[model samples]
Target: MRYPEQYLQFIEKFNEGEYYECHDLLEEIWMEDKSDKFLQGLLQLAVGLYHRECGNIKGARWMFGNARKYLARYAPSRWGLDIDQIILYIQSCEQALPDADSIPYAKAKAMAFPSLRLLIDQS
Candidate 1:
């Protein structure tokens, strides 16, 4: 199945550091159709980013890990994940933290993607 333009916009939001917006936008698509694995993975990724932005490092890590695992079943080109970029971000995030509590929301926000607003509007 093709990932929609709106969904792509949602991802761009994630790439731009708009975690809450990313979560909200992707929820629309997930609401419409829950069975699409790609969409589900994307939604999970957005939600994970939201948690990270909100200072829920454990939750964010779990969600991101899950998203990565699920998206891995599909190709980056096919699923719209920039695998290399995500891996780098994840590595950075991981390397900075001793534990979840040590991760500041502001720091996470700085590390987050900046296109979350674009995704919300696209939906």
Candidate 2:
């Protein structure tokens, strides 16, 4: 499926660990269609990662949960993304910081973050 350039940019930034930039890049496209759950899910995912990286455990957990809810309907696949994998990743992230309120910044910072890649078709 053909995707918007901003979506591609979001993926690139996401892979590069530039979560905040990913959120910024995709927010415009998402705003154009508020009902686009896929876009909203992606945006929330990016924001969740950004919050995680910034050591805001509560916010990160909240965003991650919301992202899952928004993305679940499209499970298995959507717009080249393995939604299942993304959901699993989010779950793993949540697991790493189980007690959001009690987790220390150093612990959160020490957690290994995973990168996500889109399944682009070269054909």
- RMSD per model, one decimal: 5.4, 1.9
Positional deviation of residue 114's Cα in model 1 after best superposition, in angstroms: 12
TM-score of each: 0.64, 0.88
Clashing pairs in 1: 13-115, 13-116, 15-113, 15-114, 16-113, 16-114, 16-115, 17-112, 17-113, 17-114
Model 2 worst lDDT run, 10 consecutive residues: 114-123
Q: Report lDDT (Cα) of residue 13, candidate 2.
A: 85
Tens-digit per-residue lDDT, 14-79, candidate 1 = 667676777677777778877666666666767876776677778877877777666666644345
Off by over 4 Å in 2: 102-107, 121-123
In order, the Cα lDDT scores of the candidates are 0.63, 0.83
Q: Give candidate 2's whole-model lDDT.
A: 0.83
